[model samples]
Target: MKLNKAFTLIFLSFYSFSKLLAQTDETYLFPINPGNKNYLAGTMGELRSSHFHAGIDIKTGGQEGLPVYATKRGYISRIKVSTSGYGNALYMLHPDGNTSVYAHLREFSDEIAKYVRAAQYENKTYEIELFPDPYEFAFQRGDVIAKSGNTGGSTGPHLHFEIRDEQQRVLNPLHYGFDEIKDNIAPIAQRLAVRPININSRVENRFDRKDYYLSRYGVNYAINDTITAFGKIGIELLGHDKLDGAANQNGISTIEVFVNDEKYHSQIIDVMSFSLMRDIIVHYPYDIKVNKGRTYHNLYVDNGNRLNFYESKANNGYLNIEADSTYHIEIKMYDPYGNISTVTLNIKGKAPAKQIKERIDFELDRISYQVEKNILKVFTRENCEEDANKELSIYINDSIKTVLPAYFLNNVAVYLWDLHEGIPTSVLSCNKGVNISINARAIPHQATVINAENFIVNFPQSALYDTIYVSTAYEVRTQDSLEVFSIEPVTVPLKSSFYVSASPQFSHYQKDKTHVYQTDDAGNFSFVGGSWSGETIQFNHRSMGEFTLVTDDTPPVIRPATEKNYYYISDNLSGIASYTASLNGEWIMMRYEPKLRLVWIEWPEGMQNKRGNFELKVKDNAGNETIYTTKL
Candidate 1:
């Protein structure tokens, strides 16, 4: 058995060594200064509004035509120019199969720029995609290829640099030995909070309870007092980390916590999917009033939620402060390059106390909404849903308000509420089948248009004349002609003083009961079927107007070198293929199975991808195409 184990270990070590050797050889040998600029607008693996930033933003300082160079030996495999997204983008394929992308470019190298300009003039359009043969434009390391500028969706002048695999998956550039960046400053601990969410119904500190607070006594962070609770409790914190030499404070790259020397929770702000951005809400503490944004990097794993990011076991981030006499809590934060900072906290256990003087109500001190005093006197608002079913107490200036009954709507509740001096009054449960209306028009507020139908409405001063009301679920009904309502525009000039009503645009969405149509900016009302010329029309979801059909049976041409024989999984590979499909005016989802070299498609749930002999087009990343036709 010992001999077998020894042999197995030897084999694994050899494989691991080989992999490391390959990675080192693939590293960039020389620095390619994105430009001769020191300013940066963004960095690799930064937390962003919707997604984790994939690349580094090299600052252009609002200037244009600064030269960009190839980081390694690579060929120009793909070029795309568009009004949005990348504006003018170039893809370079490297020998290691990685692709480097430069986006928001003002112009390409002279040779490529001329080619693109010619194509643009010929097509009479700004958008164009080109795939030149491999011999067209190959560059050695440190060769200039493009110049940085503001284009597409960029708000200012900067260059977006990305390293991606052949599958188009972005790889963290910092992990590949991009040695220019450095980070050593520790993260700041802003607030430490605790909640007995599911423990005892009443979450008040007894004589034996412990409270945690943030204190700045040590070099980084330390806790002076201990916390002890009898039952179940959860912890939340607000904090941010700093990178050396950067003005901005960014999210901590990783956080791990230890309770009683046992691993509890771990969280890392690294790569993420575009589709799960909305799940951020569930991961963070949702403040009832202000929506105070938490980092959304929850270290504690919740039941049944399959978020695949943690690398630790035994919940290295959540602490269970039980009846032990004393417990030690340690928190460690790490930057992207693995520099670590830690804080140690001590917690002691105690028994529950019986009766004691009631502390200040946490709800009154925590929840807040900004409103004018005069607004509550005249204007009232209806709460279509129970403002609080979590049994949270409502109070103003330390006085306890009346508690109201709960009414459910489709499992939700309908209640009446009033806001005075930025605080909501005790909820008022209403009877079924009754609609309570409140007039908000009397409130001094302004409104501005948003999109085509919605608007931003802002309340300036409180007014009693405006009222809000609550209504039962049955009060709503279907209609053949839906009258859409939006908050009237407030005649105010300042952007800060304007707001819009909730649900600003309404349409009769019931397919069998109502008809609602909308016209675009061009005054063309589009039906599911096609464009219609009318000031008014009954919108039908099922009926796509009408169309003519043409048939062609010629199969799309598929290329070999760029399509059939291409292999390599690097961030820089750009090869493409194209084809065309025709139908009787329908919608479809295109699927390409590379292994089978076949294309399969399905219509959108309620729509079809069809046009009378429409062009069935397919294109690859490198701009290759194969156009074929199926006859009707």
Candidate 2:
């Protein structure tokens, strides 16, 4: 029996070593040239507006037509072409059950281009996605597959590269031999924060969290003094990583929390699914909503978040702070290259302040409205226990229409009103206008609708994921070029697209150029395409914000950035829609950077003469066109 046990120990050790060896042995050539002076504009697992950036953005010297090579011996398995999102992308599947993706390409190789063009013409559309057989377009290692460019959602000229497992989960390419990209700098912690996790809890004697700005001390970061907290509390760190010689601050690859020298929680961003991208909100939702420029990583896991990146064997990173105890806390942040930065602090738990129970008056902060079938569901945060069996007033267009009894749900008030009788002009609660209407038959589920003098909104049942009280209003801006219909308080989130129809006064010639646009809080407009049906312009949009009608008839302006090299092009009203360039009457590739309003062509190899007549043409979304010709 001792001999058997000895054998089992040896076998286990050998198996563990073998697994580590296999992981290190799995090799991949650099997708882009490692020797090139390329820097990553975006890192894997970087936090974005609505999702985590799934890939790395490899800079191409701010130019296009750089040869993109395959990382391994693989066959082109999928090809997609579109005006947005990875404009022209290719997916190559290798024998090791991993796929490499190259996106935003200027053009494919000769053979693949021929096949894709033929398929595009046959299908009669510029956007196409095809799954080719494994045997087709097989490429050996280091074969040039395509040329990188600024296409799709790219803001500049760069290649968005990705590596994925067979299950289609996006894996950080830096994990697969690309660690050769040097990064000696460590993550920098800007601030340390602690928050109360429960309603009864307090941080620094308040319900809100407290932040401590870090001061550099001896190669690491530390708070000036320890913090006093009580009850359940969570920790958060505002930090970012900097690559050597790169100006951009990127996301850290890993974060681990240690409590009294014991590993309490960890977040590893090695792989994640696109479906779980929304979980980013719950990770550090308050920070994302309040702070626009900084990223805050939450050390504790929220109850609703299902992101697989977090691992905590005990308490989900929350500390139950009890009196007469001191907890030493340490946090380690790591970059993909294993450079580590640490921050240490101490938390002294104290007994919470004594509570004095008193009679709480019922007050409503906000009212929410939703429709289910023919019943209008009204909800609000009121002290149902104190205001039990009270009557709530429902008003339509400033007139008291009915009084309904409030029902209690988990200490909150709920009221149901039947709308099968007819749609009201406007529903009111507490004498405030809560826009509510039903243009169609019974709503399938809960929804909100807004009807105004010149506009009507239909938010479908699936449009909202939570009960929302939308505040809307309209105003005409005579100072602007056209009439504007504004929707106030645009911060509300929507799950699906909602429909809006508006009647705007326009001239006969202005009709063709007029379309609905979404305006920001600062009154800047982004064109949201709409079509006219008789006198009303209707459109479907996925955001809740101010809408307006604008007519753009100005042509794009084209000027040479450099007399011999690049051109600057821009449109003041609607943005550039299409552009073409020709050298000596031969069509040349012109890479467009919409954000910078610049378009330029890389001089092809062996084209020596700089003297030539160049012609450039640009068109805006409003069909206004501009042509410029100059001698180089």
Q: lDDT for every model? A: 0.48, 0.73
The C-alpha RMSD in Å for every predicted model, in order, reads 18.2, 11.5
TM-scores of the candidates are 0.51, 0.67
Q: Which lDDT tens digits does candidate 2 get at residues 484-566?
A: 66553344445568888887765553777877778765778797888888899999886666788878888899888855568
TM-score of 1: 0.51
> What is the number of residue pairs that collide in model 1?
70
In Å, residue 530's CA in model 2 sits off its true spot by 3.4
Residue 432 shift from truth in candidate 1, angstroms: 16
Rate residue 196 of model 1 by lDDT. 44
Best by lDDT: 2
Model 1 global lDDT (CA atoms, 0 to 1): 0.48
Pairs that collide in candidate 2 are: none
**Predicted structure with the largest TM-score when compared to the true one:** 2
| Total clashing pairs for each candidate | 70, 0
